[model samples]
Target chain A: MKKIFDFIDLNAEIQWVIVIILIILITATLTFQIWKKVKPSNLVDEMMLRTKSWWGMCFIFLFASLVHPIVTYLGLAFLSFFTLREIYTLLKLRDSDRTVLLACYLSIPFQYYFAFQGWYTMFLIFIPVFLFIIIPFLLVLSGDTTDIISSMCILPTSLMLGVFGISHLGLLISFPEMNTGNISGKALLLFLIFITEANDIMQFICGKIFGKHKILPNVSPNKTWEGFIGGVICSMIIGYFMGFLTPLETLPLILISACIAILGFMGDAIISAVKRDFGVKDMSDVIPGHGGYLDRIDSLSTTSSPFFHLIYFLLLA
Target chain B: MKKLILTLIYTVFWRSFNKIIIGLKYHNHKSLRKKKQFILIANHNSHMDTMAIMSAMPSKYIHRVHPIAASDFFGGTKLNKFLMKYLVNAILIPRKKANSDKDIDPIEVISKLLNKGRSVILYPEGSRGTPGVMSNFKKGIGYLIQKHPEIDVIPVYLDGIYKTLPKGTSIILPYNCNIIFGKKIDFHSLEIDDIVLKSEESIQKLIKRE
Candidate 1:
């Protein structure tokens, strides 16, 4: 125990203290949550009570799993798998669309494979050109063209943006090649997920507390302009300070994190449009307080491409 | 040999291409394709209701199911006669025919079929009412319930079929519907008149959902 304390770094000790503080916060929050459930609230109050559990669980896992590298990757991989499956459920498929659908499954391994192998070029090109070109000809050969134009527009775009676009978490983890200890990879991943997820919680709270101006009332009734700007400003300040603990540049860090925040909002809106078209709400009832696989990973889907694009230009290019 | 020949000719080739594309959903869909008998009482909308019923049920249970069709609709043409005899294997029951002395015994026939432990699908509304409302049922179905009161009643709710093939529409477009099967009901200890009233109530509850 004495020798273990001898080589302990100051920053590492601060991180440990932060982790401990988070654990206490989660425990206290959850206890109050149970109290709310037992004492019984009205309908609106009951909804907020359950939503507290959702926000609580998200933070507790994020705090604990941020330090573990392999645990974080596998966790993100499972999130990708579920979000893709939910997308598949909402969209209608034809016989000619089979090959394209199969190729969509291939992206799961390809995304993680690139992340695992630490390659950047193959990860970017695999989805855009290769999968893109191969899928349409397969549909053309089937010769069912009555809904061909509609199928071509909707199917490939849905698979690309919803499935392939969101899978850039693997690429995000493979960034930060400068650190000698191989510790920064885990730090960067944990930092990114924590900040992005915090945006979702804060926006919901802000929207409920002080929302007035409807942003896109036709599309998402709950979303307000006040919530969007509030979430962006909060995430930018959070991501900027978070970068000081790790090895990331400041100006681009805040600017890019704000961009990630806006795109995250877009990602949530796009998936909402899919649910709207089919006249359904909340894809599946798998998660209790959270809507579904699609609901949980809506923000992570938008972070992948831009975050990695910045990485390519800054580090590899 | 007969079943094999029929399966080879219709099921494998023709039914594959000719299978109707109607949306079907259920809450607990685990046993949807199972062989449990469903008295699929639906409000008659068009001449194609029985065909919709047959195609909607999975191929496993299609052969055993017998539909009670009105004598006025399928009792005239040779093609209709072949379909009623062979394809659906419908039990042709006469409607209110003008001044005919043929007193057909539907209660005894239905009771005997239920006694043989076979499930039959009958439209309890007698004939298709105007698009939405179900007409009052005739006494033959009520009498059948009185004779054999052990069979289960499954209420099937079909949507969009009225618009798909309405009364006077010649050309039909592709549409969808949901065939919901309720839980089984037992009437083993009820009186004869009570059996009729209860059966009527059970069917009415299923229709009231639409």
Candidate 2:
């Protein structure tokens, strides 16, 4: 045991610094949780729950980074499973939705399998070409044989939001231009989540304080024009600072952050529409004072699905 | 254990939000609050009837409540899987009857949940029958109460379930089912063979509204 500890990299200075900083942060968070003003809230509670998830996610990603890049990607794929589960729960699915549901469920494991095997072409084809084309017909199989709307809308909507829209996050594995930064994709994954979540919290706080005019009360009542305006500005600033801290370039980072926040709101809105129709609160109650599986990932369900591909298309292409 | 808690929490959120729109009620809730550890038999009028019993029960009891969902229907789909795993905490048992000589039985599972300090909800008159009328119950309740003499065999009627979301309707109608808890049956005096007959008679008597 002594010899095992000896060969271990006990001499790494950076590891010690990371350990100390993490200890301090954990201590502070526990102290805040105990003494901070804990109120029953629709919004603030959502913010803290998300922040806890971010901490958990960071540890998972960092831990995975030690093993292999494929393992890190697999860890991310598991995250996608729960995230997709959340999205699937929010939307209503007809019996015909099963084939596509199978396809959508199959996409995560398959994409990660590609990332695991280092098969870039199959991974790229799986979501866009395969999932995009197949899901709509899976809707048709629902045999709404006469009325095209249910087959058209419900089936395609879930797969696009669940599968096709978010395929590009996996595409990051082979993304060539991004390699120049040398920051692991897991780090970028963490970065995306942090900025997106921070934007959500800031928007809620800004909206609560200064919100007067409703942005689209029909779709989402809690959202406001002021909140949207304030959230984007704060997100851009936060993204800029993050870019500087990571030593990544500036203008693009700010633009990406703004994009995540704006798109995150759209995702939140779509999920809200689902809950409203179902007459249910939060997707499920997995978290204390929070709703179900879907509620936790409404943003990712909406944002990442589309955002990943858009980034690959715009930047990589 | 984690699955049960998650289901209870999921159901609580759903009930709170659904109550805002569905508009449901339970009469004489105070008498029903104190009781625990029972084989609850209820009329299966609609899907909402299940939700009514779930929402009306206290959270602690709700945690212990295991609805005996039919495997053919409840186990067959992803949505049902989510609901069974994370919303209802339901125990899906096969509905098919065992052969005459077969030793393996479905009652064994129900008997187990009762032993583990949990209450089991069994719709004795299997299948969602027509709303507002009593369907003929099978001998399963009689068989169960006879076998597990310790568990309280409580009779419950979901008063408004027929209209809440009536049978054969695909869409969930905007209606609330009110649950009425009748008296619990005492089987301490009965013999082994007499147990089945007595329990069946007791359930019939309790189903009648005064």
Error of 2 at B98 (Å): 16
TM-score of chain A considered alone, across all candidate predictions? 0.80, 0.74
lDDT of 2 by residue, A1-317 (tens): 12223455522322433354377458646755654475545454555565576566547655764356667666566556655655554454443444556566676777777755646678657766776677677766666665556655665456555544444455554455544564344445555666676677678879999999999888778899999889999999977765622334677778788888998888778888888887776755455544654565567666664555555555556
Per candidate, the number of residue pairs that clash is 0, 8
Each prediction's Cα RMSD? Answer: 10.3, 11.8
**Candidate 1, position A5, lDDT:** 42
Name the lDDT value of residue A181 in candidate 2. Answer: 61
**In model 2, which runs have C-alpha deviations exceeding 4 angstroms?**
A1-71, A83-92, A96-100, A115-125, A138-148, A165-167, A174-177, A180-183, A244-248, A305-317, B1-123, B127-149, B152-210
Per-residue alpha-carbon lDDT of model 1 for B159-201, expressed as tens digits? 4455445666553323334444555556654665565565667
Worst 10 residues of 1 chain A by lDDT: A1-10
